[model samples]
Target: MKNVYLDNNATTMIAPEVIEAMLPFFKDLWGNPSSMHYFGGQTGKHISTAREKVAALIGAEPSEIVFTSCGTESNNMAIRGSVEATGSQTKVITSRVEHPAVLGPCQQLKNKGHALTEIGVNSSGQLNMADLRQELTGEPTMVSLMWANNETGVISPIDEIAALVKEFGGIMHTDAVQAVGKLRIDVKKTPVDLLSLSGHKLHAPKGIGALYVRKGTRLNPFLIGGHQEGGRRGGTENVPYIIGLGVACDLAAKNMDKEIKNVAKLRDKLENKLLATCPNTSVNGDRANRLPNTTNISFQFIEGEAILYHLSDIGIAASSGSACTSGALEPSHVIRAMGVPFTAAHGSIRFSLSRYNTTEEINYVIEKMPAIVKKLRAISPFV
Candidate 1:
């Protein structure tokens, strides 16, 4: 069976171009960038060029971009580093719907005596900025909200939120892991203090990512050892993955304009078809201003896991918010925190598209998905 990959938000297939870019680093150019020897120094040149590429894509200075293992490390480094640098503050503020990368580290800060304020989101999954404003007034704090939500594809008003933090003299961070390739990001245009991105989400290989720290921001190091990343992060670099990420960034910058329109049209078409044919259905996020390539839907009468299994059997790759948190009884925290009805929470499915997805794939999934949902609903006692 020809598989259709609709789970781009979780991860993506590595692009051929990215893989080609990385191949040389693994075999031919293998050397420690920190070493001053001639063999190692050649690797430094390639790493520097890659850094500039990553920096250019995000509109940040090459000096400000620090290479890290993945988005989670970048987020942890940013949040922990900022609070440690600003010893005067013991409070952190973030939303209820951030990816675990952002929220998990902040939750850890509580053990160190840092107070955490968890703000709520509306049913549409947009952060409650008004509540955020109320929280910011109380103390010196750092605020982290994802640029786009992972489960629902809801694009938060990060520019406005960043400005609100500035008014209160607070540092702002945003996890742009899902938003990097799907949306246009210019860090210079937005004065956020920190932002995070992952390579795997953008057709690059996993195990490499970057953190953007605005100039003049003081950050404590996450991994302390060598002077790599200008002492921001330490340890040996993953040269092959970094090279792939650089090439991926270059490609994303090139094709972002046309791909955005094409994918958004396809995403909307798939979503509309499902909602029209399926009964008791609803979308999970704000209808307007979501990631152009993602659609999350809920089928009320059945569990999300059963729907996903049925779809998978037909070569359709999709994810259920409920099943992703398997081994645990609780439903998706994101959906639950948004105040979605408990009845619909177990039924949420996320279908994320990438630039590589074609019209044929969309049509194929649309042809197969309705019947799958029907089959699952028939057996579901909830129906």
Candidate 2:
């Protein structure tokens, strides 16, 4: 059976260049970066170079980048650190469509008596900035939102949100895990105070991520007891994975244009053909503004997980918006946030692509998708 991978939003396969870049660090350069000995001092140099690579990817100073275990940790640090350092009961603003990394922290803060209000989005899963402005109340707070939604790939108005947050004297943060490789991000030029990214989202090995903290931002340590990362994040780093992430960043910068054009075209080809062939299928979110390699569709009168199973049998990878997969009782919070009909929400399917995906593979998915949905619908009681 031929296998296809269309779940890059979940996690991406590591690049060969990233793997090769980390191989030496695991063996010859195994010295701890914290030691003052010559061997260890040299290890710090490698770490610094990796920091520069990560920083360059997002247009931040090398000193502002702090390595972490994953995107979740980076997010937790950003939200919790800001709240802790400020020590104010000020409001924490976020959208209803945020990932668990951001929402989970916000929920915890809310439970602890902090005011956390979520701004609602429209039918297209975009934040209503006017609602956000009204909610601000001119109080000192931090607002966190993702740059692009993972399920729908809808790009948020971060620059606009940043400008709005700036008006209130509150800091702003963006979870850029899905947007980092697919879009250009310049922290300085964009005016976002903090941003989070995951290595696995951009061809780097898992277990390494970074948080971009602007200079003089009010941030407290998420983990204490180590002097590493200039005390921003504690404990010795995952040295090899850090190196891998740096290499991935460099590769992304080099190949961004080719990636955007090629992958976006492939995604569009598959998406349009799928809709044309499937009678009741409709796309979700704004067509004009989305990540280069993602498409969300709903097949009416069908269940998403069953459709996913049918596609899986034919070696097509996809995902459903069911609560079972999302750690919630309802359908995907994103689809729900968009106010999608419950009937349509149950049939939502996400197909996320990557630069490595080929036109032939996309065509293969399109060829198999209609029949798979049809087969699932036939057996589906809802249909």
Candidate 3:
């Protein structure tokens, strides 16, 4: 069985180059970045360099980048911290299709007496901008929306959304964990106040992430302790993972064009083949306005977990929805938000690709999927 990984949206394999960059930090540069000694200073300089590299990937300044433990922490820092800084009276707005990281924090805020509005999405999983516009009124607001849907790969119109938020004097935050490596983001052009990114979504190691806080954004610190991450996030830095993340960012910037072209080609090939060959199958989300390396398909009359089990047996990894919500038996909130029928909703599978995927690997999955779907449907009681 071939080892094909189509679960990049969950987490990616660390790049060899990123590993090489991190090795020296683990063995030689094992010093606290906060220390005043020479070894500490040397490690601290690399953290600064990593900060710059992470900022460069999204067209941000080095000073605006705040290192966090992962994307969830970044989301929490942006959502909870911004609300704290903006005062308890601020209303929170987000979409219904957001990852649990964004939605979870927003829900907590709601429980704490903050006014929370969840904007709905269209049948194609596109954000309802009109709804968002309506909600932007009536209070000083903070809008936290995902730049791209993790399950369906639907890209939000963030540039327009951010501009609208600014027009209403609202703070805008984006969970760009899936979008950072897949899309070209320039924070200056978009005018978003805050954005979140995770390292593992790209080719960097897990347990490292960053938040881009725009200059002059009044964000209260999420973690309170010693002054680390410019007094934003307080903790000892993960030096090796930070260095790995920086190298991964630099590599992503250089190869983005090729990644967009090659990965999309493979994604399209897989999506198109499965839709054509499998009966009662349909693609989800807005095909024209989605990420290049993602596809969500629903196979009617079958359960997604079963498909995944069979696919895993053949070494082809996929997902039913966000890995964060994988164990829940219910269909994903994302698919349910799009109003997909119960028959299709429970059967939806997401295949997210990466720069390392090859044509041969894609072809192998394409060849194997139709048969698996047919067999599953044969036993499916819904059929």
* Top lDDT hit: 3
> Which residue runs of candidate 2 sit more than 4 Å off their true CA positions?
324-328
Residue-wise C-alpha lDDT for candidate 1, range 270-376, written one tens digit per residue: 99999998889999999797999888898897888888888888888988888444766878889999898878988999999998889999999888888887888
lDDT of 3 by residue, 278-352 (tens): 989899999999999999999988888889999999999999842233777678999989999888888889999
- Model-by-model lDDT, in order? 0.89, 0.89, 0.92
lDDT of 2 by residue, 1-383 (tens): 87789999999999999999999998899988888899877878888899999999899999999999999999999999998888867679888999999999999999988899898888887888789889876787889988999999999988888987888888898999999988988998788888999999999988999999999998999999998889888899889999999999999988999999999999999999999999888888878889989999988888777777777888878788966565567889889889889888888999999988998898899888888777777887876
Counted clashes in each candidate structure:
0, 0, 0
Model 3 residue 337 distance off true place after TM-score fit, in angstroms: 0.3
Provide TM-scores for the models: 0.97, 0.98, 0.98
Candidate 2 residue-wise lDDT at 304: 79
Q: After superposition, how far is residue 140 of candidate 3 from its true place, in Å?
A: 1.1
lDDT of 1 at 8: 95
